[model samples]
Target: MSLSALLFPSDAMAQQSGIKRIDLQRHDLSVFGYETVQARIDFEPGTAFGMHSHPGEEVIYVLEGLLECKFQ
Candidate 1:
């Protein structure tokens, strides 16, 4: 599997009724040694994220299926 495929799989579906969410990253958040948080998002497919950038840093990763990102 390509890196993209490994990081992000196919489309995602919303939680069915009575089924609880069990995403580790969502349920168990990562602790960053910072007081003022800037940005943090956990996305399933169909979840939306706007374009982003920062001071010489452009970081992107997938916590779940195919976090389709576009910036311009």
Candidate 2:
């Protein structure tokens, strides 16, 4: 298993009860099982994710806010 960090807006957080979201299921994470993805997500001010991806070919999307994404 892997671990990640994140943040969310008060209103959004209130709805989720202070839970952040860093989704790894970005358009089939299974495609890249040889990669290490790390990043921070904050919604208080805004939402952002750092570099994320595995080896081989894959597709990704934030589905919400803009993603500062990079592949390695």
Candidate 3:
């Protein structure tokens, strides 16, 4: 399964939680069986996501507001 499928919430969940995701770009790497995806996610005030895992490397950048994260 794709990383987005693993990490991104379903449409119903997103609508209920006031979360929006915009996929910016996707590309297949020159190396065999490798790919990269970039996306932007927006969350409403007081909204949060449950603990989740990604299938590959993940990076996050916050354009505004403070973000709290927990890792285990």
Candidate 4:
């Protein structure tokens, strides 16, 4: 399946849920002695983020959406 298909089963679902994403920034972590990335995310009702991973670390804060997360 395509990446978007893997992440979102349906385009209608993605749109209905108001899934908006912005790649805030990216940088070479060598200067910080660790590899990491960060960004701001917005999710509307019915939106879901598929299972994924990071190389080093990750942190997330809920700006909204009842602050729920699902994993498999």
Best by lDDT: 3
Between 3 and 4, whose TM-score is larger?
3
Estimate candidate 1's alpha-carbon lDDT, on a 0 to 1 scale. Answer: 0.32
Model 1 superposed RMSD (Cα): 10.0
Runs in model 2 deviating more than 4 A are 1-53
Candidate 4's TM-score reads 0.53
Tens-digit lDDT string for candidate 2 (6-72): 3222234334522354543333344454433433333433433444433353334344544454545
TM, every model: 0.33, 0.25, 0.69, 0.53
Rank the models by TM-score, top first: 3, 4, 1, 2
Better of 3 and 4 by lDDT: 3
Supply the global lDDT for candidate 3: 0.62
lDDT of 3 by residue, 3-69 (tens): 2322343455456656777777778878788677676677777877777665566666777786776
Give lDDT per model, in order.
0.32, 0.37, 0.62, 0.46
Candidate 1 regions exceeding 4 Å error are: 1-40
User: Which residue pairs in candidate 1 collide?
Assistant: 8-66
Candidate 3 lDDT score at position 22: 71
Looking at model 2, residue 36 earns an lDDT score of 37
lDDT for each residue of candidate 1 in 1-72, tens digit (9 for 90 to 100): 001211121123123332223222212224453122222334444545334344333344444455455657
Clashing pairs in 2: 7-41, 7-43
Worst 10 residues of 2 by lDDT: 1-10
